[model samples]
Target: MISQSLTLTWRSLVPLKNSPGQLLAMLIQPVFMIVIFVYLFGGAAGGDRAEAVQYMLPGVLVQVALMATIGTGMNLATDIGNGVFDRFRTMPIARMAPLAGRILADLCTMTVTLAMAVLVGYLVGFRVTTSPLEALAGLGLVLLFTMALSWASAWIGVIAKSVTAMQGISTAVLLPLTFGSSAFIPATDLPGWLTAWMSVNPVSHLAAALRGFTVGGLDAADVWITLGWTAALLAVFVPLALRAYNRRVR
Candidate 1:
């Protein structure tokens, strides 16, 4: 199953090779976002663009990671719509192979986006105070968190009627979760009610943890919270996604 899934993961990435422009477009959004945020709103947030970059880079990465998971569902819906999944069913591969493959392939794409985000951030004065290894671990954490979220997306994609529907559903959920949390701004600045909600927001923990790793102070509490969320998401969504995949393929 592992080998089959790995092969299918490679197969899933073939589209990017054929349409390199798509990859470029995906990488461009982070650059634009970092520039706009740092130059326009940075002064208000952290007193200057450089300071803002230091504080905002982690949050920006959290937003980007969450946004990227939407593509997992959209891509799966497209494959199903095009009958590619139906063709896979005729093969003798393990039932989990296709679903696992899609998630793994999405992880690779997530890494690219994360790297681009960091590069753009650096250009805008985002510096990592932690060691390179620690920063890499932070990146791994983001990927793991994203992978857990993508399972839920995959389940939605498997059952969604169309790619548009998948995207719509994922966006509706993600927008609230990503933006409502402490991703772009300090939760303390929010209203009492919003602050209450943000306190428990999983994305907030993820963002805080990332910031801790990048800025030289590891928040052990936030790290534990984020890991708990990741485990919980995978625990709930992985089985559901596998079931959805089987039902859809059958």
Candidate 2:
């Protein structure tokens, strides 16, 4: 199963070789977000551009990681819609290989996205005040959260009736999660009701945990909360995704 998944992972990535534009777009996305959010909204939100870079970059990393999962769903939906899974059905490969392959391929792209975000943040004056190990841990945490979310996205892709449906569903769900949380502004800046919601928002915890990891102040509570959320997401979505994959393929 592992070998089959790895082969399919390469198969999934092969398209990027023929179409470098897709990979370029993925890498450029985080750079654009960093520039727009940190530079444009920094003064208004964080008192200055540098401060904004410090505060927003971690949040942006969480946001970008979350947003990247949408592609997983879309790709899965597209494959199903285009009958790629049907081709897989006849092969002797493990049933889970296709789904696992898609996810592994997504992890590769998301790692690059995270790296690009950090590079852009560095250029914009965001520094990791912690040790190199902590900075790496920060990236690892975000990637872990992203992997959990991808399972949910994969379920959506498997169950969605069409690629357009998958896209719509993903955007509808993700937009609120990204914009409603502390991804752009502090929770204190929001109204009472919104701030209340932000308190429970998984993204808020993720942002806080990432800030702790990359910046000077590391919060143990935030890290625990983020891990809890990751576990919850994986518990709910992993089974759903696998079941949905089986149903879709069968």
Candidate 3:
């Protein structure tokens, strides 16, 4: 049952046929952020182009993965809209397979996004002075957050009344989550109230964690803060998504 369900995921990747453009769309923002930050505002950031690139890279990478997950909900709505998931229910399959497969497929997309982002970062002079193992750890941290959000957003997809609602809801949430965090500039640059907000923003912690890792080692505080948010988000959303799926099947 599990094996066949896993096969469902691989088969779903078939969408990449006419969907190659989807992945390219995901790359656009990361690359744009890299270029604009390095070329336009690098001087104002009080650092070399490389330093500015490295700082902004994590923020954009997180944005890439987080943005990339919007499709999870939209696709779920599409499946419902097109009657594809309904067809799957008539077949013998693992109860959780559809959602699981969707998440796996999205994870693969995230991997591709991550690779493209890092490549752009490197091209713009972001270099790792860390050990190979630490670099892997840094990459792993980003991937971890990516997958966690993917899983959480899948729930949003499942429960959304329509594809449009999912987009509106997710976008509304993402704007503050990105801009309210430390993505563009240090929290110190934020106003007093906003700086206070940044101190507690989960995305701020994530950006800090990724930034610290890029520089060579993990920040213990960043690790704990990110892990806490990941746990809380997963705990809240995964079951909600499962319950939504049950309703969907009914």
TM-score of each: 0.97, 0.97, 0.92
lDDT of each residue in 1-250, candidate 1, tens digit only:
9999999999999889888788898899788777776777776557667778888889889888888999888888998888898999999999889889999999998899989999988877889998998898888888989999999999899889888889999999988898788877888787999999899999988988898889877779888998999999999998998898888878
Q: Rank order by lDDT, top first?
A: 2, 1, 3
lDDT of 2 by residue, 104-153 (tens): 99999899998988888888789999999998988899899999999999
lDDT of 1: 0.88
Flag clash pairs in model 3. Answer: 73-157
Which ranking of candidates, highest TM-score first? 2, 1, 3
| TM-score of model 1 vs. true structure | 0.97
For model 3, the local distance difference test gives 0.77
Candidate 1 — worst ten consecutive residues by lDDT sum?
Answer: 40-49
**Candidate No. with top lDDT:** 2
Instruction: Please provide, for model 3 over 1-250, each residue's C-alpha lDDT reduced to its tens digit, 9 standing for 90 to 100.
Output: 6786588789778878787677577667678867776678766454677667767777777777777788777877778778888888888886578877887887887788788888988888888776767666766777777667776677878878889998888888887988788866788876899999889988888877877777655678988888888888778877788788878877
